[model samples]
Target: MFRVIVRSSISLAAFAAGFPLSAAEAANAAATSEEDSIVVTATRAPLALDEVPSTITVLDKAAIDRSQDIGATELLLRTPGITVSRNGGYGTTTSLRIRGAESDHTVVVIDGVKLNDPAASGGGYNFGHLLVGDMERIEVLRGPQSILWGSQAIGGVVNIVTTIPEKPLEGSFDIEAGSRNTVSARAAIGGRTGPLSWRIGGQSFTTDGISAISPAFGGVERDGYRNRGVTGRAELALASNFSVEVRGYYSKARVNLDSTRADTPDYAFNQEFLGYAGARLDLLDGRFRNRISYSYTATERENYGPLRARPVSLEARGENRRWEYQGNIGLMRGVSAVFGAENERSQFRSRSPDASLARPLPPFANGKAEVTSVYGQISVEPVDGLTINGGVRYDDHDRFGGQTLFAAGGVWRLPTGTILRTNYGEGFKAPTLYQMFSQYGNAALDPEEAHGWEAGIEQHLFGRALTVVATWFDRTTTNQIVYTPDATCNAASTNPLCFEPGSTTVRTAYYLNVARGKAQGIEAAAALTLGALTLDGNYSWIVTEDRSPGGANFDKDLPRRPRHAANASVSYALPFGLDIGAALRWSHKSFDDAPNSIVLDAYTLVDLRAESKLSENVRLFARAENVFDEQYMTAYRYGTLGRAIYAGFRGRF
Candidate 1:
């Protein structure tokens, strides 16, 4: 068992008032990049989309405002090469997959701080609580990007940049009410004064939600959900070439849960806290920049069963503390380098109380691990209209020894507005604490590893009024960790733990690296704008399968990973200061379990939206989601949201 230093963690989290100024600035530039062609997430450096060999999607504030979506996951679903599965309406357990990769393989970063819960089943962030409040930008970089993002980027990286004050004094507010007795309110205020820049935001949301278990499965109850969160960031310019920053985020949520067998008074509450502190230094006419930082994150979860002797059924906590030093340098006219070194400490503890047992619960299943890493990347433009980049990273885990990853990519833009690109990348992922040390854990598991490559082309026509891109990618993962069930264990099990976690009773199985998986896909996207009308769409054909030789589930489809998905939206601005839009989303059938015994059928959904400019700084908007009231399932026997309507107004000053 390991002990956690709560006070030290809090102090470290407060080191920086919030987000680093330098990284924030780079992300801001990504949002306003010329014609949305420039991106920063690809290499943590500003580069035009045409020069980025990897696939990426950027959503600026205007695009976010145009969608008028309440949650972050909802908005992200509109992007390409992504999928989401929610157990029920808002605040339920949620998973997001990119390019058919495991949900935990993706890395989520907010304002330069990585987010994950070491105690969770897969040690991943739950999309349920990521709301679209007081955020200005979102970037989705797809592929196995471990070279620059470290081990967790086996799938990709989702970088969320929050609002930063650009004016002397500015504020924004959003208020809305919707079907299912849902209501939401959010507000933010920030400004720059002298050498200090700061921002603060808060949000409140609640809803009488649908049953967690599908009604088709005999569910019958009106579950409810509630959430509250706050974010704060501040930066101080201590000198002309040096500045310090600090950022913090906190959220609390209550989600109603039920059993598929029947409706019951069961629920779970979750809390998350993130803190960061950093300082930046610039030299040599700003050509050389450096940042030193520290960050801390903690997640707490509790489940309740009212009928049980002890209402508290489960309690768990996870913490991550990190320190880093990064440097960016421009060596020559077309050569630049990004180098960084970082160390992270991750810890988790969990416990469950039994109503049947009169004795108290056993000691918490607690464990801790640490990893140190260093990475270097170089970008160069060897010839006109062409750019190439390569990167390498090395990580040393306390127990797992060491691992190395490499990536390379290149992009060429011709005079005819044609772009060609290709990329190759590798990834590494160490097992989670719960997967290696808990009762159901097997400490002998090996780290998961992956490699992937992609080739793509882009064509622009009509004076850049229309753009289209197509890409094909393939990936292979070995020694992937998976869950296994072994009802019999006499302390004589040969191989155990196959993953998923959070049970306190006698262990039947444990986590182990036993599976090999592969995925291949094609992605196509298009965007067109003519006069006051705009249209954009994307389609993805991804096939994920278990390829382990002689394995029981060999060639079976990965659970919840659809083979096909598409999204399209069209909008037009009317001369009367009103805008109308429509969206269509479709997903193909997928397996519900590893054995592929259960099947989930395909489904389609449509939504209608309209917004009117009330004034230069305010707008009124409304949307009808799931207009056809389509009934479907992303998870076996779990309910999916039906038709719902929402109306709201947003203002900025």
Candidate 2:
């Protein structure tokens, strides 16, 4: 199976390379050169990439389509120092780890709305399942960004922005077919006339997964499912430089699973859903900008089969709703100031209908949490080729009380197009509902906190044909919440769930506040342009160690994260209007469990894409993912998608 995957990957790569990927192709694909890209909100406002003072990755439209054959988790597998873990197959509740950071330490945002589920045990958004249609671009910023984004921003932040049409009409429809009987269709439309504009789209997909393990052994369930919904907009001309706009999206999916062993267990199916709605208003011309937005999202999970067969049978649900208002003023030609305030409410609930028939386990209590915060930042350019930025925030968390954070940074540009930048910041994450009020909850739990800093440089050589960037970052967290064994439980009971508590009948899992850890890493990225050819690559190395007092292994590595990762890709344009692209991804072995016990081996994979213009307004494209067909575990006990092929047609009328 692996050999076939590899051969197909190589053949596709060769085919795409032999053809030409033109500038128009790149534009239609939504890919961009490093030097020409711009990012916003990194410094509390819009800014060019080189001026951000941090390590960031941007995926333009072209890149998103190129990886469409794969799920969200697999698409990011090639990113350096990042790891994705899923239950078993596509659309399963996926989790993302960055630089060895915990799954809950990363924050995600869509159209300026934070997607973190306040009900999560650790205030972070779940990246495992998300809608991918209608996205204009994706920006990933590494390292701590708590000063501006708050809490879960400790590891980094992923911001997904959708495209807004400026014209009177525009739309596209795409249909694709691949292995595993996979089928997919996506459509989007947007337009503007006078002072009104709106956009919307959706996608549906399903497949029988590839075989990595035997079905009789409960390995790799074949038929899985996926679905998505999206809407967006911007309305201007109501008054010069003023507009009111709305943006929102919804998605749901079901996935099949196969355990590696017949007796291990099987959760044949799982499902998920998310919905969001918000509005943004631009006011006071170009001098001052004011924006207000609100969003609500929810998630639920269902496990299939008999009670004894499913050790963890149940229904779990959680939700988060937030409202924010922001203001930015251009104080001077080279200076700007921003201030914002926000309020958020969250809840989590879980129920076990079969606990009576099956072995009973401790249950989590339904709980609520709320937060209010005020933040501000300023940008300054004291001299030519140099910019400085600083910000601070104060939060009153209902569960953990008051917390404050601050950050400062600067960027310097040289005459040769080389630049230097650095930043220092602090962050905090309030304890989750489960930690404070659940069945085995600890009432005295405290918020987690961290301080972080980084330095980086970017250089362009050979007259802008080649670009390079390198960055080093480090962060330390305190008051980390960890669940230790309830020592009172004895070994004599046939059903271990019958263990008694030492001093209380409530039963205790012992939430310890005495935990500390630090993470450090380095990353490099580059892009090169030579004639009709373009090459891009990224590499990252990360290490995290627990250092809490009386810690078990202060020197051991973190779980579920690779110490090293690298990805490289090449694209070329041919004279006959043909375009070809290929990419290689590699990652070192890593552990899955918290104790760093269970291990997964290292693996590499390849992907290829080819496209050609069938006419002035029509085009044909095809892609093959998991080209190497390397069999590897996506999660601790689950199988990943096998080598798959996709062919499609896309065009605008």
Candidate 3:
């Protein structure tokens, strides 16, 4: 049965790719937009955006510098088909959703290394700690992409590539100060000498933040946060066709916290580290390329309450190790194939101490899992102005057995400046250890599965001064895991979830795989550049529904997912080497919880920014966010930033 399923998936994917480029051509062809021509996250290979059949959005260095966003998630919010929610201010819990999918459904990759924490809720990476320090480029790919990314890509992928120096010796620095006593400083220097290239950078940020809870909800205390991080990378060329590379990233943060609707002397400390080493070799006169790598990631989190019996409230550690090999074959002109194999091991240990218990803390609850995956993809240009691609992947999980995923797409670029593209893909995610071995965990959980497709069109008009794109995407997910409330389970009861091996405490909730999810959306965007002025805008209408059989709110919209969202920005460059820009963002109302008992009202925000060149290597910038002090809540009763001002300077050498 497994072989049959795998065989059929490959065959169908090829057939789907070979079909005519009619309605199916409604995808992203040729690098998303004219300004961005290369996409790396689509097939884990660098392909011209026009040759790739996936919907992608790229943010170059110019865009990043203009936004002046302190956090990485802030920069992503303006992109098409994306939304985010934060429990409070910076350093708080932040979740980013793509096309209305769950936060964890998307995978994050930085410098060719994936990031995740098995100890975190939903086994996802926390965007709160990911600041915009030394980032150079970001690519957002929509829809299920497990065929190449393996797992945790049911929604999409965010691939971030940092700076690679173009000169022998280069240096850069930025210093920014904003409202609420917030300040940030960053610096980096790198040199490319001979066959060796190396770079190192560091950043520090501090802020006196607003309350975690909404002021209207009786919150009346100020929270503060501090963060520090460092990054380093090195690559050596042993020969013309062989090379070795190494990368490392480290970050540490501390944030104050408040209790439920009240002030408390509580705080959290977090630390994350990622290390990678890899080698590359070229065979058969560069027609065949090969790479082998090993990567390791670790995350540590701890929370403390000063007045509790034990200062430590919760402690958790998650680690991941991966070994991978990849090969690329260039059979002939306009023809190529990519294949790879990967083995990964993930483990997590956590412990929570009750403030009411005076006894010694219990030992950590531990869990571990492993997976092996192999995938193959092929791209062909059977005719002029047309490109077709198909891929297949198989993964074997120690706990959930084996799963296979398939993906196929096509791109058609016409001389008339019209491009059409379409894609189909499948995704799978195994249950996280946190959901199966935590205090209120349930071990009998099944894996989540998803399938999705997209179609879109890109049009360039008036000598490419005006560009527009429209894409429609739909996805269905089964065996979804969710936290279900169970008030009746007590310590005296026979339920294992209610009591540990020898504990006498009751449990309020448990994780189970009894939900189904569906998301459909339309994303439309346009860009017009008329000489010194540019205009860009995008709108998304996403409807996410819970379709679990016999479940409450079965037909209701998913909590926290708004049905309508839009963004617009305009920038104008003056003759005196100065640039000014303004932006507006809006979101419709959404549910606050699963029961639909609360509603988060719609709101809009406006921002104004300006920058001037002081010299060839220095720039002065300033920005005012939430210009009107718009009061809105992304998470019910959670505080949001109001009007604020910030100024900064950038220097490059």
Candidate 4:
């Protein structure tokens, strides 16, 4: 099944690439305009993209609709300066690594709410299974955002903004089928009457994946995944000074994981369900804007495999719920301010239902966390063409205790159509439940903290026909955790459990107060317009050094991070209403192991997309991904899907 999907995806890419280019001849001219492009919500409000000082990328609706895959992670591949790492194959928990930052350090938000699992050990939000077809836009903010977004904003942020209806009774529905017996359906509806507006959407997808790979030590085989969900939202204009918008979304998905090295006969099933509700309000004579949000997430996991003949299995279930409220107040004209307070409470419970374990008859672990934070940001323009931004935040965590963050930055417009910017900030990440109390006996684990800054310049040429930006940054982190070997275990122990007694393993892994690391990098991105054609590309180079715990190793490469990565795309739109695009994404493979002992080969993927307006209200579209069918592994010891294709119809009324 997986093989078939790969083939179809390749075919689709070929067709899109081979489509007649003559139709786009009109728009192929080098003249273009960027004055009307929306800035982005990354600034906490709408601003022109060129006006914002930081590195930001916005995937507009057209780009979203034309992308080959509807999955959030897959769509992100189209963006520059961002990388999505999948655990194994498609539909798995796709992890993201941004600017050499760990997966958990990057925050993901939908609407105005954060989406991390407080109950999970890693405290990372998986983008792999997120649906993308129903979204209006996706914004990627690179660099540190702790001052603007609070904790866990070390690497960057990805904000998925949904579509809002512009008229009464607006809706769109799409159904597509291709290889792997894959089938998907998505629909959205929205309307407005008087002072009220609302929108709702739902999606369902399923696929029987390819045959398993090697290192098969488990009993399960066959790769398969399924998902379904719905989202509803409404906005109310209460009065001239007060308005509100509320939204809620829920989704559930199950995945089959390859646990063994060789197409193992065994597979693990991971199930997840998440929902969020949030509201926005305008207040204080149009000077203040407030938002309140809450979210709930739950997961049930079971691992089926073999432990030396006796059926080995693991089962666990957990949930996380949180609430946040914040407000931004604009005052003193060129001086706009933002302030907010939030509280989050979460609980987790996990039990081993497997009778194979010595103490399998009970729930072994349970934990909870309560967190609170207060933050504020101010933007000031002291002089014409000169803007300054500064902010600070304080947070209290039930586990790791407390921490503070501060930031300051400025942007100056040069006389020759060039912009110069610089910024410095501090960030932190609290240890999750797993790090604190999971099977490991680490009752003490401090939060990871860091300080960093960057300087950059942007240039506009040919009367905005071309744009260029370059930046250099350095960051250092400390209080890193290191695991050391315990000294009490021996094979002669009579007790059934003595921290690896039977294996003569007295070593226990615990979070230590030792370990430190530093990272430095340079990045450049550019966009050039020629007639009706546009070319966009970005490149990054990084150097990382780390000191492991127990003096075992120091100055080693950070895990799973590459020294260089790049992306490029070329798009053209014709006057007759036909559009075509092609893109190339490449990553220099790094290592999955801590000491850089293991190596994953680098890979490049080619994707193609096209759309033609059959009429004013209707259009035909198609896309091909991984056109080369390159054999690759995104993670250490895992295999990625080969190729895939998708095509469908779209319309508006």
Candidate 5:
């Protein structure tokens, strides 16, 4: 099945590339204007998509509404060069990987605020709780973007932008119910009044989910999950050239889980709060623009064990606060300069009955760390149809001292409606507090470093009705952190390096920066629009190597990363205000352990959806997911959903 999908996608790409120029021009004669889209994640300033020398994928509001997926991670799974691993069904722990990089290597941003957790084991953001209820747009930038987005951008960046009021009076609501006794609802209201505009919205979701652990692992009880969230935004236009905006979001979730020891039940409760305030000012008659912003994020988690004897509970909390100022100035014709400075402080706290789980929090002892950074970027079009961009950043960490990073890229447009783009950049990630202060901590550990490059070509045909792109990327990392047992001690001999010799105690392990790794991949994507029909698809081929020296898994494929993956979808609009769509996803076999001991088989899934307009202000929709009921596992002992159906209604006023 995987091979068939790959071959079909390649054929589509070839067809788009080989189409005649005369035919394309004739077909595009009646087509609408192909205005270039603007994106802010590629650089600090807004730039046209074609001018940015990076691989970018944008999911706008229309696309989000059409998919009808309840979770944000489901929408991201279809994107090229991206993959997701979940321990169970929806609302469980979820991790995202870009171009075969580790989950922590990707950075997530929500409305100009970073979402990584300082208290988590690897300081990575969990996507399990993120829903697409009030999102206006999402931009995914592929490659090393640390120069512009700071740490944890070694793989890429996922920037999420929320909705704002666009009219004097408007609102929308949706209600849905599905398999496994699931229920979901969302509503939003927004309006503009004089110089002030405001928007507020909320969502509630719950489900009687399947067991998190597979029955093969001795699990039989159903686990349930519930989530609730709210978001708000307000903006004031103080003057013709200035504006102030504030945004806030809150979400809480409780989920029933299966214990690692079969048959036992566990539960987790989590909450997140995010706030942002910013002001934008236009100077020199709009040629010079400046923005100042402050953002804060806090997260808390609590877990409880099964009620067999006495319940065990664990609690953890983390917070991040940041202040930023950015300026963009039009220095000359076709040239612009962007500069910014930021100050950030992060703290973490944990409490548990077990001393090993809560010792040595941070501040090294005070529970906080501060970082200050400054960055500058320049964009220029020295010649017609050619654009160039360059940037540099310097970060000063209170404990790790300072580091400098640089990035450069260019985009060229050919007369044949072909675009050539390339980029190269550096990325680094500081040691996490847990890595530095835990029982197995290493205070002297150095930060991990990475550098990579990517090049791609995009072609537009049929008057922009058909578009195709292909890209190749390579990245290498040094000083990667890994846990290793005491080198001088073995099961047989104690060489004095062993903390305890001639005792039955387990040997201690420590985090070391002695590993190197590399990942390379090729991605191809195509989109076609004709009359009332639309088709989109993408394919990715990735190769990842764990080159850690003296390791049993040396030069082996990284865990949970499939070598092949593909996605395809088709949608059609009929004459009676009705639409229909179908989608297919496939993945090849992959390993579940670093030593390649466990194998997860290949699997394919199909989904179908339909919607009809009941009136100008109302619509009805339904969908069937995993139509074939294919059984698959993204993790070794986790259960996945089977065939499920849902129906819903949406209304606007």
Candidate 6:
């Protein structure tokens, strides 16, 4: 099946290249070089897209504005090598997987601050509440990036950069209303004065959503969600070669959810705060550059059940603090090095009352864990159009001793506008505090590790008006963490690992480093621009397997990862200051459980969008999601939103 898809995609690319299109028009549209796009996530320093040897995707502010997506997850769904599984509608629990890696294996950063939750299961960042109000760009670097990003980057890294003041004075406002009684509003203002610049933005989103659980499960309530967020940033230039920047973000959300039982009411409130401060300095006549930064993030969640009946509640909190220093130095022409050091600390706490016992239960907590790391990389160009990069890192954990990782890659560009790239890297993820100190935790568990490689080719044709890229990657992971039932202790045993094991109460599970997994995939993408019309598409074919003993899921396909996925989009600029666009997203069937007992059917979604320039500073836009209203599920028993329409207007000054 994978081979067939690849062949078909290649054939289609050839056909599109040969399609009758005016050469004059194509040349006019080819003024921009796709390979010249700048990205900062692949390496600590900014590099052109073509210079990066790994697979990456960048979405700039213009693309974000054109997509008309209010949530970050929605925008990511269109990218290659990405899959998102949401448990419900907007503001519900959402998981993002890259290259078939575990949700927690990927690192998420917003304005240099890590957003992973130490108290959450798997220590992953939840995308449910991440809005797109103040975003400037998003860069996704795929593959093992631990040499630079440290742990939890076994899959890749997602860096979100927010907007900063670029003009003396600038501001914008937007308001939108949509189906299901949804409303959203956003506003931003920013300006620069002398050597100082600052920007501030806020957003509010609310929706009367659909049932989180499918009707077949007896769901009959109208779940709803509300979210508010604010962002601020400031920068100061103290000298000609030195500058300081500070950023802060805060978001709060309230969500109504279906209860475990049909008769009960359930709701949750959550908040997140992120802060960052950094400084940059240049010395030795710009031959040496240095950066130092500090970041802190905090997350809190509260859940209430049956609000009318002495509502029982649970509260949880997580925090992370980090400090880092990085440097770049030029030793000679075409030869440079990048180095960095970082220290991080994490904490988790949770509290809940026992409703049945009518007393406060003991709080679960992990005091703190610390990790220190140092890494360095060198990029050398021995010849024209040929670049090579190699790096290594060492991480010391307060409780787990130390580990080292290495990576190497290179890019070679041919004179014919053809590029060849290859990369190999190693990654490791330390156990989270919850995984190590919780009730079912195991202090003896070792960190998970992965090694991977990728090779790709990119070609530009038709005066660079069309670009095609294809990549193949493979990865193997060892010592993966899994929960297993204790065989030595059964129903009557007093062992903590087997609470009423054989009985109906609940089986106790303990974390174990006993799993091995492998994932391999092919990704193909193409973009074409012809005068006022643009077309883009991508396809992904993945095969993932788990080899874990002591469980029924041995050698089974990973859950929630489909074998095939594809996306296509088209947009056109018409006369009279009008624009129109359409997109299609499709995924093959996937299992919802490790054992493959529960199956999620294949699904396809279509969306349409249109916008008109009402005036030089005012624009009107509208979009329709799930235009065909297909009924399907990405997760078992979770309901998906149906057809929805939204209209909005924007004003800039």
lDDT of 2: 0.65
Select the stronger candidate by TM-score from 2 and 6. 6
lDDT of 5 at 161: 68
Question: Which digits, one per residue and each the tens of the lDDT, describe model 3 over residues 167-193?
Answer: 689989999999999999999999877
Model 1, residue 644: C-alpha shift (Å): 0.5
Q: Rank the candidates by TM-score, best first.
A: 1, 3, 6, 5, 2, 4
Worst 10 residues of 3 by lDDT: 1-10
Give per-residue CA lDDT, model 4, range 415-479, as digits (tens).
Answer: 79888888888888777665565554355567888788888888889986887878888877787
Where does candidate 2 stray beyond 4 Å?
A: 1-37, 210-223, 234-237, 258-284, 306-312, 353-355, 358-364, 490-510
Give the Å shift of residue 630 in candidate 6: 0.7
Cα error, residue 345 of model 4, in Å, equals 1.2
Tell me how many residue pairs clash in candidate 3.
Answer: 10
Cα-based lDDT for every prediction? 0.83, 0.65, 0.83, 0.66, 0.79, 0.80
What shift in Å separates residue 41 of candidate 2 from its native position after superposition?
A: 2.9
* Global local distance difference test of model 6: 0.80
Error of model 5, residue 9, in angstroms: 23
Using all chains and alpha carbons, the TM-scores for the candidates as numbered come to 0.94, 0.87, 0.94, 0.86, 0.90, 0.92
How well does candidate 2 score on lDDT at residue 279?
Answer: 35
Off by over 4 Å in 1: 1-38, 491-506
Off-target runs (Cα >4 Å) in candidate 5 are: 1-34, 308-310, 355-366, 485-507
